[model samples]
Target: MKLREEDLMDILVGATILGCGGGGSLEEGWKLIKRELKKGRKFRLVDVDDVPNDKIVASPYYVGSLGGNSKDNLAVKSFILLEEFIGEKFFGVVSTEMGGHNTAAALTTAAELGLPLIDADMAGRAVPELHHSVYYIRGYNMCPFSVVTAYEDKIIFSRTRDDLHAEKLVRSIVKVTGANVGVTSHPIRGKIFKRTIIRNAISLAMDIGKSVRKAKEEDKNWVLSLLELGGFLLFKGECVYMERREGSGFTIGEFELQVIEFYLKMRT
Candidate 1:
C-alpha cells in the first residue's frame, strides 16, 4: 500500500503541475491509474541496484493520441494481453516512458506484477513517439514486447531488432486501435540498464512533485521551485489564436500567443 489512493492523486496533480503545460492531463491519467488500483491490486517500487544484471526489462505504457478524447482506464486489459502474448514468466525490471500518465502506468504494472519497478526511464522527458528513447539510441530490442489494441481486446506481440521498427509497428497498430493503444517495448538486460536508462527518473519525478507540494503548502513559489528542478524556460505569452486537428494520431496545429510585444509559435 505504499502507493495509496491519496498518494496517486497527489502524484498525478503534482505531475501535471510539473508537466509545465505540455505533459498529458492529470485527470485522464489519474482515472486510468486509479481504476486499476481499485481492482484490489498492489504495487511495489525497487531501486535499480536491486535488479539482476542479465535479467530482462521492459516498459508498458499508454501510447498514441494527444489531448482531448484520449485513451482511458482500459489499459489494465492491455497489460493482461501483454502477459498472454509473452506466454512466459518474466523476471526483470519494469520502467516507464516519460509522460505523467505513462510514469504512473509503468508503476501500476509493476505493482500488479509484483515486480521490482526501476526508478529509471528511457526518455528523460516525455516525447510524442516511442523510438525517441535512450533505449532506441542504445540498440535495445523491442520484440518479445506486448501491445494491446482496441479490437476485441486482441494483443499484438512484436519482436524487432531495431527499436524504430518497433515504434513504427506500434504507431501502425495505434492507427488501427483508434490512436490510443497500450504498448511495451525496449526489452533490455538489467545489468546494463545503467548505461542506457535515464537513472532515477521515477524517483526524480516523485521528488519534484513533493517539492512542489511542499512549496505550495508553505505559501512559497511553486513555479520557481519547479524551474529549479529541471524545467526549461519556454516562453511567456497570452493566448491570441489557435487551430488544431488530428492527423495520423497527432494533434497537428499552430498557436499564436502574444507576449508583451513578442509572439511565439506553439504546437497544440
Candidate 2:
C-alpha cells in the first residue's frame, strides 16, 4: 500500500490509541507526516513477505522524550550512515514501536529516502523502555546500533552482549548528546524480521483508526470499537491530577481520572 497524504490522520490517531497513553505524541507524528507530504515525498508500505530473506532492514525510532527538539532527520541520517558503514543498501525501514512519533520515524525516513516501510513493527504497542522490544523477547541481538542527533553527531556500536546493555548504552548516549536522538539497529534479514515482528500490526492500527472515526460519526462510543478488538475499557473520565518525575534520562508519571459512583477501586 502506498501511504497517501490523508492516511496520515487516521494512522496517527490509531497509533496513538494503540500506544495506550505511553506512545509518542500525536502532534509530533502529524508534524512529520505533514512536513514530508508538503515536500511531495512518497513511501511504499510492504508486508514482511514482500521483503526477501536476503534484504536488509533497519528499525528507526526516537530514544528520548517526545517533547524535546526531535524535529531533525537524524534517523534518516543514521540510516544513510549505516549503509555507508556496512557498504550495502538497506532494503526497508521499520518502526521500533507503534506510536505517533515512532511510526513516523519509519514512514518519514522511508518516504524521504525511497525505501519501503515494513508493515509490521518491533512492538505492537508503545512502551516506555527499550527492553520492552519484541525483538529482544524473540532473541534478536540489539547490535550494530546507530545513534544520531540534530548536531549530526553519530555513534555506532558494532554489537552489544545483551539488549539490557544496549538500552543502557542508548540512554547514556542520549544524555551525552544532551538532546533526543534517533536510533536504528539490527540490520537483520527480512526472514528473521518476519519471524520476530508483530505481523500486520500496522494494518490493524489503520482499521482501528477507521473504526474510531466511524463510531464518532455514528454518535456511538468509540472506545467500544477498541473493545471489539480484545481491548478493555478500563475507565472513562476527565483527568483530575497528573504528576511526573524525570530522572535517569526517563520521565515516569501517573494520573487520576475523575469518575464517581459505580467505580471499582484498586490499590496501586
Candidate 3:
C-alpha cells in the first residue's frame, strides 16, 4: 500500500487506537510525516513476501518514557549503527509496535534510508516492554542487535541468546541513558521473519483509521466501528483520574474510567 501524505492523519489516529496504552508521541509521528513529505520522498508499504529472503530485515522503535524530547533522530542513527554492525544494508523496516510514533517509524526510517517499509510488525498492537513482542516469543536470533540513544550511548547485545535477559540488559541501559533509546533488533532472512511477524499490519491500521473517519462523517458512534473491525470495547466512559510514574526504565500508571453508574479500573 502506498503511504500517501493525506493518509498520515488517519494512520496516526488508527495506530493510536491500536496502541492499547503505549505507542509514543503523536506530535513526533506528524513531524516525521512532514519531514519526509518535504523531501519529496515517498513512503510505501511493502508486502512481507516481496522482501528478498537473502536480505536483512529488522524492527525499529523507541523504547522509554513517553515524555520530554525522547522522540528525535534516534531510530535513524540506530539503523546506521545496525548496518555498520552487520556489514550489510537493511532491506526493509518492520515496526515493533502499533503506536502513533512507533508505527510511523516504519515510514520515517524507510524514507531516511531509501528502503522499503514492510507491511508487517513484531506485534499487531502496542506493548510496553520488548519481551512482549512476537519476535521475542518465537525464539529468533537474539544477539548482536543495536541500541542507540541521543545521549551517544551505543550498546550491542551479542553474548546471550536469551530474549528475557536481553530485555533486562536493555532496560538497564535505557535507565543509564536517561530512560529511552532507539533499538534495531535481529535482522533475519525473509523465511524466518514470516514465521514471527504479524502480516499486513500497516494496512490493517489504515483500515482502522478509515473506519473511524467514516464513522465521524456519518455521525455514527465511532466506538462501534472498532467493534465491527474485531476490536473489543473494554470500557465506555470518561477519564476520572490518571497518574503515571517512571522507574526502572519503565512507565507504570493507573486510570479510572467512569462508565455512568460504574467505574472501570485500568493499569499499564
Best by TM-score: 2
Query: Each model's TM-score, in the order given?
Result: 0.80, 0.91, 0.90
Candidate 3 residue lDDT tens string, 1-268: 6777767778777888888777887787888778878888878778988988788898777777776344567777787888888898878998888998888777788887888889887878888777777767776655678888777777777666577778888887878777578888777888788777899888888889999999999999888787788766566578999999888787789998878543244332
Candidate 3 minimal-lDDT segment of 10 residues: 259-268
**How much lDDT does candidate 2 score?**
0.81
User: By TM-score, highest first, what's the ranking?
Assistant: 2, 3, 1
Question: Which scores greater on TM-score, model 1 or model 3?
Answer: 3
Candidate 1 residue lDDT tens string, 89-151: 445445455556766677666666676567677776667766777766776656666666656
Count of steric clashes across candidates, in order: 3, 0, 1
> Model 1, poorest ten-residue lDDT window?
68-77
What are the lDDT scores of the predictions, listed in order?
0.64, 0.81, 0.79
Per-residue CA lDDT of candidate 2, range 137-249, in tens? 88878788788887888888887778888889889877776677888887888788878888887787887888888899999989877777766655667889998865566
- Count residue pairs with overlapping backbones in model 2: 0
